[model samples]
Target: MKTGTNNKFWKYAKIITFLLTAFVVILSGCVDEEQNETESGNTTNNSQEITGTTNNQGTTGGDYIYGTAKVKSIQIVTLESFPVQVQVIAKGYLPDGCTKIDEIKNEGEGNAFNITISTKRPKGAFCTQVITNFTETIPLEVRGLKAGNYTVNVNGVNGSFELPVDNVPEETPGSMSTKQQIITEADNGTSISIENESTFYLKLKENPTTGYSWELNLSQGLNNISGEYCPPEQPEGIKQPLVGAEGVHLWEIKAVSKGNQQVMGIYKRPWEKVTGKEENFILNVEIV
Candidate 1:
């Protein structure tokens, strides 16, 4: 009788153990599903994702894998000398390294710009590095408007910026003097050392017609004297003015401190969900 009792106890124990194991598996599966759902909320296809950069040298044809980066926002700001300022914000969840923005244009029919911010491969860069997500802002210049209406769109979202009569610059070109030194796209990775307070003129190449623009990532210690979009310089040998020509983004930064600070920019489309980063640039400045 004791032997029979022992057998019964062992059988019941086995059944309970099996039930617990099944329960654990089911619970684990549920937890995994929840995580995936949350990620998918702002997620797109890995192929279309622009969160970070990869070391692989791929083309737009999907031959290679690029970092996922896309647009976050685009807005137009009206300041003293700047009549039309396009501010762009892009994100790279995975950044390969620092990439320079190639171009930003106005591609849309009604004053739309396309932003082309891509990584600049070094002399021997394989570009396989993929870092985590970080946000970047790039500024583009826009000018020559007749004080009318315009639209700045990012990731399919539109931000309307108006140039009121009061914000217009003086008609007499010689009356106003610019106190800014410009910083262009080529100034990336370069450092500037200053003793007293100084200002910078940041000019970047942009094509706003394709829905891309630039903006200054607001920071402390640096005073913004002015920001504006200057009209594209008329290319030589061209007679007629092009409707949407290549342009330059002009931004002025006043450094008021005497230490080290890093300036950043991001080029992206703001409306779509992303998995990687757009193009990014980091500028180092020293005030001594």
Candidate 2:
């Protein structure tokens, strides 16, 4: 009976040892798997952080990042007046709600204009993943350019426009074009006939240094284009122009309608009340 009891006790001890060893092995495998998963997650996060820092084109005010805008289309609009004016309409999209148009730069070379539209957004700010639409109207500096076909590039979108004539005005009396007509104070109180849609210049003498200027009034059939003050010519030996000297007040007018038109001017200080004794000039024009 003693030998049988000892044999049973040894068997039981062997079974207990085998179960403890299996439990330890399983626990060690679980721990190693968890560590490997944690290491892999950290590596992925580090790679994303590096990419985010290197992809931006630039930074603004140490808080914003700059990127190029995505332009979709462009339209060219030309005004219907002298010394032609051109405007460009650009349409584009933004990547997110937080992104906004930052700047627009235009550089002209030869007959081509290159325009850059830039975008800005706060760095690392959470924004809606929605697309936004944008439109911008920009004017071109075409004053000195000769008449021809010109190309415009706005953020890689291309367009073209044509200027049938030079976009420069007749600035001097000796340089007047065939289409420009001249009138002086000597023509006041006289009636003249001109072609329809013709442009005329009214040159009058005044002394603005005394706080007096020419106030012009146009009839409904005419259009007052522009008025400018021409300073008196300085003597050859004199370096500075004469003070309180006489100057010419030049006005550019257009006859848009046929029939009778009138241009009237009154010389007086703007703050002073007008009286019948104030000097005045008038002209009658017939457009046919």
Candidate 3:
């Protein structure tokens, strides 16, 4: 009876050990599979992180953004009391795989404004990997704020501008309507006509913060186009240029009167002199 009982005890012990070993192997496999899945789904985590960061833009705290998105320019539309209005514009040279803006967010109050934008690839997409460029404008408003200094944040860019109590008119958006025509630097050696009235726009690369700007030197026939034109003056084509960054300095002149004239100017520090007028231009004009 003792021998039989001992044999039964050993048999039971071996069975328990084998079962325990099988269970451990199965558990280990499940654990490894879970780890692999987590690794493969990291892109989801990245996207979630971006969403969180984007929500933080116009706010003080949130996730910091990561990517190539950036603000290209900003303009104050109204700094006076009725309500503060600003126009923030941005641009991107996206990778070929990206075809459109995926999201856009703007937040904050009169004192601070934040803007965020993102681009994405189309779903089930077949896209060529090429570089492309795009431009976008974000209009922001803060109600009931009077003239004062304000902050604007576009994506991760920050800027400070004042809202003056003075009321100045802005330029007519690019005109193809009236007898007026808009001309640029590209028309340097060409001739332009003004039967009714004409607005001539001369643009060049400039850095205003460096005290370097373009000024129109009216030479009799051509008059300057400077009557309350574009209060919060902005460069026609260049988006948010930095303080010392290069941008297009647009100069305008309204030609009214008949006969021939010339528009001339130099790009330099106002207090300096232009010896050869190397950085200058002489544009021919005709008014009737």
Candidate 2 Cα errors over 4 Å, as ranges: 1-62, 173-288
Better of 1 and 3 by lDDT: 3
The runs of at least 3 residues in candidate 3 whose Cα sits more than 4 Å from the true structure, single-residue gaps closed, are 1-84, 166-288
**Clashing residue pairs for model 3:** 72-240, 73-240, 96-130, 225-253
Taken over the whole model, the C-alpha lDDT of each candidate is 0.59, 0.86, 0.63
Candidate 3's TM-score reads 0.34
Best of the candidates, TM-score:
2
Models 1 onward score TM values of 0.34, 0.45, 0.34
Clashing pairs in 2: none
The runs of at least 3 residues in candidate 1 whose Cα sits more than 4 Å from the true structure, single-residue gaps closed, are 1-181, 234-244, 272-275
lDDT, candidate 1, at 188: 72
For candidate 1, the lDDT comes to 0.59
Worst 10 residues of 1 by lDDT: 59-68
lDDT of 2 by residue, 191-226 (tens): 777778888888887888888999998999889899
